[model samples]
Target: MNKLISVVAVVVGTAAALPASAQITSGSIAQNKAECQAQFRVSDLNGDNFLTPREISLFRGSMPTELSGREVIHRQDFISACYATLPQDD
Candidate 1:
């Protein structure tokens, strides 16, 4: 189920960001996922991949504009979706 969600997020994000004919290279995807992981790891504060309630609160405090503000992010699940959906620099 999580895998499916991740796939859908990737498809949606990619389609929203890229053209149908535009090829998404593996390196690009890997790089994007790495970046997302790094950012999340930093935001996690306690080094847990999952965001605690406090961590989530603080994250929303700082970035108060995203879906993370509205939903809890399990350590594993959001990483999967974000790495799949976000761009390399994101």
Candidate 2:
């Protein structure tokens, strides 16, 4: 029907006008290192250079399954694992 066609057109138009969702991708090693360091700094509530299991839980709301049973994690390792767990945009 014409009304149905008009509704479909409007929906399509609105979707086209909206900004695209951000694409998540792995960055270069240097970029990953920097990002990890920044994240570590922000999450390090006690100002220690390392992240304890408790700190990680607080930072991410829950410990990543990949880090389960681990007692401590370095910044670089945490970042790499976290990035690996991210769903690919494609």
Candidate 3:
């Protein structure tokens, strides 16, 4: 019984000494905008700074609602929505 208790205590102590996992940070607006812009640039494909319906499909639900009926998504509009529409680290 004493040996079992000692082993259990040691295991608990070792676990307590280990570092806790780091929490993810919600990035600043500027950082988020930059990231979104980069993704948009890659998805643009044609370098026209506008995403057509087919390109918009790549982003799926991440695109802003204002773009629903539009034929194309402008770069500025996408950057504007990044803060509110995109999922952030919580």
Q: Each prediction's TM-score against the native?
A: 0.44, 0.44, 0.49
For model 1, the stretches where C-alpha displacement exceeds 4 angstroms are 1-31, 61-72, 87-90
Off by over 4 Å in 3: 1-31, 86-90
Lowest summed-lDDT stretch of 10 residues in model 3?
21-30
Q: Estimate the overall C-alpha local distance difference test score of candidate 3.
A: 0.56
The list of candidate 2 runs beyond 4 A from truth reads: 1-39, 57-60
lDDT of 2 by residue, 1-90 (tens): 996586456434543443343211123121333444444444554555667876665555423357666778776676676666555667
Q: Give a tens-digit lDDT track for model 3, residues 1-90.
A: 996586456434543443332111112222454456555554464567898887676555555565577778888877676656656788
Residues 1-90, candidate 1, lDDT per residue (tens digit)? 996586456544543454333433322332355555544544455554667776566445322233454455666765666655655552
On lDDT, the candidate that comes out on top is 3
Q: In candidate 2, where is summed lDDT lowest over 10 consecutive residues?
A: 22-31
Considering lDDT, where higher is better, how would the candidates rank from best to worst?
Answer: 3, 2, 1
